[model samples]
Target: MMKNRRFSIFIVIILCMVSFSDLKAQAPANDKASVKTFVQHFYDWYNVLQADDDFTRKHHLSPFAFAIKERGNYFDKPLRQAISDYFHKPLKSGETGLDFDPIAAAQDTRSGFQTGNVKQVGNTFRINLHDLPKGKSEKEILAAETFLVVVAVKVGKDWKLANFIYPAKGNMSQTDLIKLLAHQKKFGY
Candidate 1:
């Protein structure tokens, strides 16, 4: 039984990989552009959170909503405002701030999805993130490691970060949660 379950997971991952491979060829340029766009959009929305009337509207965050918890800080906010605030603030070069560099990114055609895996031993850290010097020790690996999955439907020529969340696993990771909330925006579920 255990072997079966593991096999099932393996199959799922294989399928996901196959999906990504197909996209790799056709999507090399297209998906790469989307991935780059998502990063720049997210970076500006987060690291360069300076108030800009142009970006404020360009972000189209008013329609989106995002919420994720880190340490004790609740990361949920109106999509536009949340990303706006993120870009509005300035972070020091090596500081453990909201914005962190992505180690690698891939575009999956089968799923029409763009995903990126952030390494665990990179310049930034996202451990429990409260105690700092002491807190840094525990989740040192987890801190720097997280994943961002994005869903985009082409608009004109560029792809925008419709919605994104952190490393995935259970509810704690919050990717599915964001998707759920994204769906319930109108009905108020």
Candidate 2:
């Protein structure tokens, strides 16, 4: 009963959310320098995925990786499954799972960081994200979305997801709703 146009848009939106997730993940490097490094590293990882990343490489995520998702049920997995499932393929060690074009990706990254927040609490790192609603009231409700994450300590100088929660509508998955889409060719729905 659903049209392909709707299906395509759904897929695009999910992928964009996954990309945003990547852009937002970080462990917070001690000081301002460390914070910048942490954010830049994650940015690079996202860039690779945007590029030709055929398989997903392992990530040293913060301990509070999915804290927001867990508390709010926005996502159930350690990270967003929409992103994880797409990169389920195996990748060579030391290779980037995702890569982005340097020039354009840099510009986008710069703009994105201009409006974001990252905080640390002992071993866990928390994140809060908000964006302008676009040509409207500055005092009015802006993006009005926030997230809380609690990251865990990893091996020396590293960290991975411990728990995270994100307030999300948790939209019905397009992958499950649609039938006969190329991705579901095997089931032949």
For each candidate, what TM-score against the reference?
0.31, 0.29
Question: What's model 1's lDDT at 186?
Answer: 30
> Model 1 reaches what TM-score against the true structure?
0.31
Instruction: Residues 1-189, candidate 1: write the lDDT tens digits.
Output: 999999999999999999887664343334454444454344333323223335337655421222121111212234444444444556555543322221112121111122233212221112111111222443452344344543333334544334344445566545433444344343332
Task: In angstroms, give how far residue 107 of model 1 lies from its true place.
Answer: 28
Q: Candidate 2 residues 84-156, lDDT tens each?
A: 4434545555655334222122212222211135566654454433322223343332345432222333435
The CA lDDT of each predicted structure is: 0.36, 0.37
Off by over 4 Å in 2: 1-36, 50-115, 129-154, 168-189
lDDT of 1: 0.36
